[model samples]
Target chain A: MNRKELIGQIREKKSFLCVGLDTDIQKIPAFLLNEEDPVFEFNKQIIDATREFAVAYKINTAFYESRGIEGWKSLIKTWEYLPKDCFSIADAKRGDIGNTSEMYAKAFFNIESSGMSFDSVTVAPYMGADSVKPFLKFPEKWAIILALTSNEGSKDFQYLSSDGNMLFESVLQKSGEWGSKENIMFVVGATRGEDFLTIRKHVPDHFLLVPGVGAQGGSLDEVCRYGMNKECGLLVNSSRAIIYASSGTDFAEAAAAGAQAVQQEMEKWVREL
Target chain B: MNRKELIGQIREKKSFLCVGLDTDIQKIPAFLLNEEDPVFEFNKQIIDATREFAVAYKINTAFYESRGIEGWKSLIKTWEYLPKDCFSIADAKRGDIGNTSEMYAKAFFNIESSGMSFDSVTVAPYMGADSVKPFLKFPEKWAIILALTSNEGSKDFQYLSSDGNMLFESVLQKSGEWGSKENIMFVVGATRGEDFLTIRKHVPDHFLLVPGVGAQGGSLDEVCRYGMNKECGLLVNSSRAIIYASSGTDFAEAAAAGAQAVQQEMEKWVREL
Candidate 1:
């Protein structure tokens, strides 16, 4: 779950891709609803279909959140079905007051606490150190802070000049000190590939959870070109582009094919690493 | 649900307090566990109990997300249960790439798209303008960006120098331009009460969703001193200190009492406005 172990998995699989399990009920084929928990069934099938090709599973809490209680149970069941070697992320962008954040950390990282422990959770750094540090208090549990997101809005403030440097650069420098490279990561959206070089100049060694690939139209070659590190530190996520490849009975197969294509592409990158 | 109407609700309530519905399962009274969906039931009772006294409800998505599907349903149901006059918020700190963010916007603001529509969502402005603009696509919905938080690490990066301006200051000034005051709000932690004065200098007219007032020890008087505008452009939230006021069967009564106390203090400030 730590950086070294995470990197090792990519090296072993020859794939650095983290398939985002942003399973939307509406998006998944209607057939799965026949199962007790449609979301869990869909996730289990996806994990079974793609585990061999993926190094990590990033679950976006929003997709399940839109569903409510049953959705949460499905999320838990999906986590249960995921293999241990593949890193698990809550993909829950959470940050709050220190005391409250401690509870959130307990929920996502502590097996004794929530029963569903994720290796990492995406944290909003806007609340500052206390909000992010609570997640870091537990060693080996990574805090993926939002830096230069690929979204167009990233240009709104991330590039604003304080004097000479941009705002994101300041976030990169200051948040970097809150934890070690082993525990801290940045969410550098894949669309903003060019900024990856600049981002690396700030935190050269930490992992970057590069989202916005595939369905979001971010270029894989460009991201790897500007974002990759010596350790192959990048978890490029593709959700909609892969998971919902088909809406019929062959959906799982289609998903597998989609994952295979990305894995094949990543295999090339891994060998180069 | 939009800013104008939300302002009207605040004026009607003679209070600008938006009690945070961070309904942590363990924190709720054990009696609620007997219900089919304990979190939902707890939120329903709390909403019903506090509806007449408050103008807005800020549901921290983390509490529901940690629980998974069922939690999400609870959040949605809670949203539906709130009085129409009260503004409903998905306190989900979401920001992603352009296309991905478009989906998030659909999930939160657009009823047909997200299934459950919330009036506003809390967003982390780390990614800049594009990440935030996607949220603003909905005419009446809002994008509440993080400005100054109350956490310890707030100093770590939020105040870090970027060129000559503080990073948070740059975020406030730069991000404030992306949308009009109607749709763009800022999250200024109540724990940083006096600092709100400085933040307001940058975002004077926009609304603010202030946390840290109750359980986090943020003083209402201090926040009102430097933060409140003529329109009472503030929705101070109190989560744990109110919702978890007691764990016994008297939980709902306790929550109402807790909410009333904050509302009373908030009313004092509103009278001046």
Candidate 2:
């Protein structure tokens, strides 16, 4: 799916919240431990319950990855179960050499090999174009590169003066040339708060995947304030704050409620594109 | 272990080849494929076979992660099995919020719930200091941040103009201030070859985890020429070229041969340091 369709879903649902499935095994309801595929069961229930309030589902591969083969299968099964209209993300943070990346692209997007496919995948741009180009090669597939993240360490090197410019700013301006706004995006953490304004100056149209809301305390209002564009280009993610909302048997319902709250707030903040 | 200790091991072994344990399920021999934990068994065999020859083992979380819970367990077992003197890299590429990062550090280095304890981990600096700092907070544990990658799409923004500095150059200089040379390291792709000289100018004292040799065609002569430091601060990583050296039952032995070939070349190169 492309950027337009992503935004269209938000408009259709009047919500912009992207449910981040950063599921932790130990935190899931104790009941699931007895199930054959506990991870898949947890994801299935959460996805089923939260599908209504979210426009996107961002799966952090680490949580599933920490599990291994069974985790990979869970990821595949979960992807298969997600609604077709909702944008799917493989938050794998994959970026390697060109050839390896090509295979990664094939692994995630090639539906023939695995029935699971993600519309976008988070990529680390430290490898430069060759690393990122492989992901963007698919006509409609999107690559959300890391930009000015909202972490304190972002101040360490991203903002460091290299030659004369900061690294994150350089990433924003240079990476912008590889693809149009419709195909590329940036991961701008909401926790950093004000960095969004400067980020907007670099790529005014591309969507920004903003995480760090809820538990991390990144204000949703501030993220939308400086980051939003005429395209309504922002996908604010909340993970632990949603998925683990409640650890009881009603975990799925509680997650849906947490997701609903974010959607309600997003409905008021979304720009009229 | 800190940079000095890792360097000592490299010198004692007279090798810089850090064989990467990036085991994919499909890549393992057919016999082990039916095991209770194919990934862990494959890793055990490889580690046992290569432990004498390799200076370190970098466990790229992606291959294990593509699996989920089973993968996490395998990661724990691999870390446990790894020799203490040998540098154990989580290769998780994790960088998140301060609190979350602290949790990650605990998961990898602290022997609490996660029986895994790795010496180092790869982190994406896009989130800045808070994301990177939490990892650094652990006394001897280190953070291997991305500096210059060898991927195709990296040109997208990594080299873009921010005044005159390239994005990666800026990150290197900035992130250096976060931790002492004793703890911080950079991931400079070997494919960049001579660009190592350029990276060295920015981080002359810190260790570098260089990936992309062998299958990626990154030459040992070229990378060592520009990458080697006075302290011999270079942990050259070879994944596919070494781990997947053969598809047959003799894969582990073939992998040892591939690793030995690179180590022989690396031995010659280390003379300059």
Candidate 3:
């Protein structure tokens, strides 16, 4: 989805929530395991329950890849099942050299080639510009480059200071030149809420895909206070807290409740816009 | 394969050559397309021909993933077909948060879960220790972290100097503490021959997976001169140059000849050890 459409969706839904489907087979309700494709069934219900509150869905590819061919099958099915109106993200932190990266771009963005075309795919900027540019070749598709990640590991190399800018800041400044705000977004962890001010200084207009709001203990309010642009340029993701709210028979309903609660909270923030 | 076994293989084969099976469906011979599984068929031939000279086989996951389900099927089959004696690497430069990284570990290392157990998997170090540690959990498995890459884009952030060391240097220093030399390896691109000297200074004992010779214009002699250690700590990879040696019916023979030439060069390097 383009920047305008993404903002419009956030306005209409009154939420910039991106529900992350980091669905693990072991974590799902036991009864669902009796089904042929439990992972897909779980995702289908989660998508159905949470779509009302979310403007985007980010499918973490690692969750599906763990099952091998069966996992891949579930991933393709889940991608097919995602609502077209909602922006889709294949959270497959993929990047390589120019030619190899082209194959990755085809894997995620070319539906005819890979049977799934996400609106965007999360990319690691470690390999630099050529590693990311392939994804930008597709019109309206986006490349969400990892900036300041939420994980503890984010400190390892991301914070290294060079020329007075943190490594992630350098990532923002250099990668920002590779693509425009229209086609590129950055993944800035919500846990580092105040860092959003620093992030905004680099790419004020680009949307930031924030993960860590729910289970990872990132404050949504702080994220909004520091990160939100005039266009509400933020996609705060909540994965475990929303999807695994309950492992009971009413799991989908529980997820709906969890999403609705977050959405209601988000509604209050978007109201100022 | 453990450190000792890998070293033994290098000595036994008299070569430290890693044949990269970056098999693209479009690039394979047209006659192979008539087979039940063309990509797999093509890979089978390439493997059969190259195994004698190669101590390792690096499968670039992007090539398989681009075809989606069928591609994944080919990957599993090719993984199954790989010679058990040779070190297998799922060159799927994957990294994420802790839980997500665990899933990725299972995807590549745990055969029971993912149906493919590779000796090592390439990991991007942008996320840091936690993102890479899970891959080291499995006994005898390895996480080949990306330090300096081969592409033009590597110049962007990798060379960024911070605290008297480049970003890639910091990655080598910090990530070196995550796992022992036995379980840890770093990808020091062959294109940057002189940079290998700097890389050796950080983790002299750890093995380095070098990619960029031949097709990428890296000098094998220079890589060996600066990168090699007492154990001949380098698995130099050549992908397109060796795999796509010929596009006609003589492709397999051409690939075998190409691999042999590299192996002969590698033989000279290992003789010193």
Best by DockQ: 3
Q: Which whole-number lDDT from 0 to 100 does residue A214 have in model 3? A: 82
* Segments in model 1 whose C-alpha atoms lie over 4 Å from true places: A24-46, A69-74, A110-115, A161-165, A191-194, A213-227, A244-258, A261-265, B2-4, B28-49, B102-115, B137-139, B161-165, B175-177, B241-261
Task: List runs of model 3 lying over 4 Å from the truth.
Answer: none
lDDT digits (tens) for residues B1-273 of candidate 2: 877788888888888778898777877888897888888889888888788778889987656544444555676788888988799888766766665566567667766545667888888766677777878888888998887765555555566545556667877877866887888988887777767777888888888888877766687878887888777888889888878888889988998888788878888766666
Q: B267, model 2: CA deviation in Å?
A: 4.0
**Candidate 3 positional error at A65, Å:** 0.2
Chain B TM-score of candidate number 2: 0.96
Model 3 C-alpha lDDT per residue in residues A157-223, reported as the tens digit of each score: 8999998999999999998679999999999998877899999999999999999998888999999
Number of the candidate with higher DockQ, 1 or 3: 3
| Candidate maximizing lDDT | 3
lDDT string for model 1 (B1-273, tens) is 677788777877887778788888877888888999998898888888887778888988767655544556676778778788888888777876555566677767766644678888888777667768888888788888888776666776677665566777788888756788888888887776668878888888988888888777799999888988988888888778878888888888998998888888888887787
Error of 2 at A24 (Å): 4.9
- Which digits, one per residue and each the tens of the lDDT, describe model 1 over residues A134-190? 899887788888877766566666676665667677778878668879888888878
Worst 10 residues of 2 chain B by lDDT: B62-71
* DockQ of every candidate: 0.43, 0.29, 0.93
